[model samples]
Target chain A: AQTVTQSQPEMSVQEAETVTLSCTYDTSESNYYLFWYKQPPSRQMILVIRQEAYKQQNATENRFSVNFQKAAKSFSLKISDSQLGDTAMYFCAFPSGGSNYKLTFGKGTLLTVNP
Target chain B: DAGITQSPRYKITETGRQVTLMCHQTWSHSYMFWYRQDLGHGLRLIYYSAAADITDKGEVPDGYVVSRSKTENFPLTLESATRSQTSVYFCASSEAQMNTEAFFGQGTRLTVV
Candidate 1:
C-alpha cells in the first residue's frame, strides 16, 4: 500500500516571504508521479505542481517548486513570494501502482499568507 | 465547459436513506474516481473506474456504491447514509496513462443527518 504523509497540519507565511510544506510517502514503486493540489474557499481543487520520480532535477512552476528526494521518499513543496491568494489547503498525492491508477493523498497542510 | 462536473453541489439527506451523487466528464477519459475530503483525511478514495464497466474499491469503500455504465459518467451511491458519511465529495478524471494528471471537479458537500 502507498501512503502519503504531511507532517504540518497548519502553516503561516508573511507576504513576499517563502514557505515550504513538508511531505513524505511510502512507496515501493521505482518510478511514479507526485502532485500538489490547492483547494481554496471556493471548494475548487487546483493543481499546483508535479514531479516525476525518475528525474533527479526538481520541478518548478513559476513560484511553485518541489524538492523530490527519491531515495528517502520525500517530496516537499516550496512556495516563493507568498501572496494572500496562496492561502489554502495544499495536498500531496500520488497514483497507486497497477491499472486502476487511483490517487492516494496526504492529510493536507492548511497554509495562510498573512499580509 | 469542456471538463469534469459534479451535480448537487450540496445535498442533505436523512440517515438510512439512499443518495446518489452524479459525475460527468467531457474529455472521455479512461479513469474516473470518487474521493471524500475530511478535516484530517485530506482526500480518501472511495471508488474508481478504469473503464465503462471496470470498477474497483479503494481505501475506504465500506458504505458506498458506484456505477460507470457510460464512459463519461460515474455515479456514487450511498445505500444507507449515516452522520459519519457527512463530508465533501470530489470527482476526478484522468487519462489512461499512469503519469498523467487528474482533473478535479468542484466537489459536492453531502450531509447525512
Candidate 2:
C-alpha cells in the first residue's frame, strides 16, 4: 500500500512571502508520479503541480514548484510570492500501483496567506 | 460542460435509506474514480473504473455500491446510509496513458442523518 504524509497540519505566510509545504510517502513502485492539489473555500480541487518520479529536475507551475527527492521519498511544494488567494488546503497525492487507477492523498496542510 | 460533473452537489438522506450520486465526464477518460474527503483522512478512494463495465473496489468501500454501465457515467449508491458515511464525495477522471493527472469534479456533500 502507498501512503502519503504531510507532517505540517497548518502553515501561514505573509502576503508576498514564500511558503513551503512538506510531504513524504512510502511506495514500493520505483516508477510513479506525485501531485499537489489545492482545495479552496469553494471546495474545488485544483491541481497545483505534478512531478514525475524519474525526473531529477523539479516541476514548476508559475509560483508553485516541487522539490522532489526520490531517494529521500520526499516531495515538497514551494509557493513563492504568495498571495491571499493562495490560502487553502493543500494535499500531496500519490498514484497506487504506479497508475491513476488508485490515487491516494495525504491529510493536507491548511495554508493561510495573511495580508 | 466540457469537464467532469457530479450531480446533486448537496444531498441529505436518512439512515437506512438508499441514495445514489451521479458522475459524468465529457473527456472520455478511460479511468474514473470516486473518493471521499474527511477531516484527518484527506481523500479516501471508494471505487474506481478502468473502463465501461470494469469497476473495482477501493480502500473504503464497505457501505457503498458503484456501477459503470457506460463509459461516460459512473453512479455510486449507498444501500443503507450511516452517519459515518457523511462526507464530501469527489469524482475524478484521467486518461489511459500512464503518468497523466486526474481531473476532478466540484464534489458532492452528502449528509446522512
DockQ of all candidates, in order?
0.76, 0.68
Native A-B interface contacts kept, per candidate = 0.71, 0.63
Question: Residues A1-115, candidate 1, lDDT per residue (tens digit)?
Answer: 8999999999999999999999999988888899999999898989899888988999999999998989889999999999999999999998876765788899999999999
lDDT score for residue B94 of model 2: 87
Stretch of 10 with least lDDT, candidate 1 chain A? A94-103
- Leading candidate by lDDT: 1
Tens digit of per-residue lDDT, candidate 2, span B19-111: 999999998998899999999889999999999999998989999999998999999999999999999999999886447788999999999
Candidate 1 residue spans exceeding 4 A from truth: none
A1-115: candidate 2 lDDT, tens digit per residue: 8889999999999999999999999988888899999999999999899989988999999999999999999999999999999999999998865344578899999999999
Estimate every model's Cα lDDT from 0 to 1: 0.93, 0.92
Cα error of candidate 1 at position A93, Å:
0.6
How far residue B113's Cα lies from its native spot in candidate 2, in Å, is 1.1
Which candidate has the highest TM-score of all? Answer: 1
TM-score of each: 0.98, 0.96
Q: For model 2, name the residue pairs that clash.
A: none
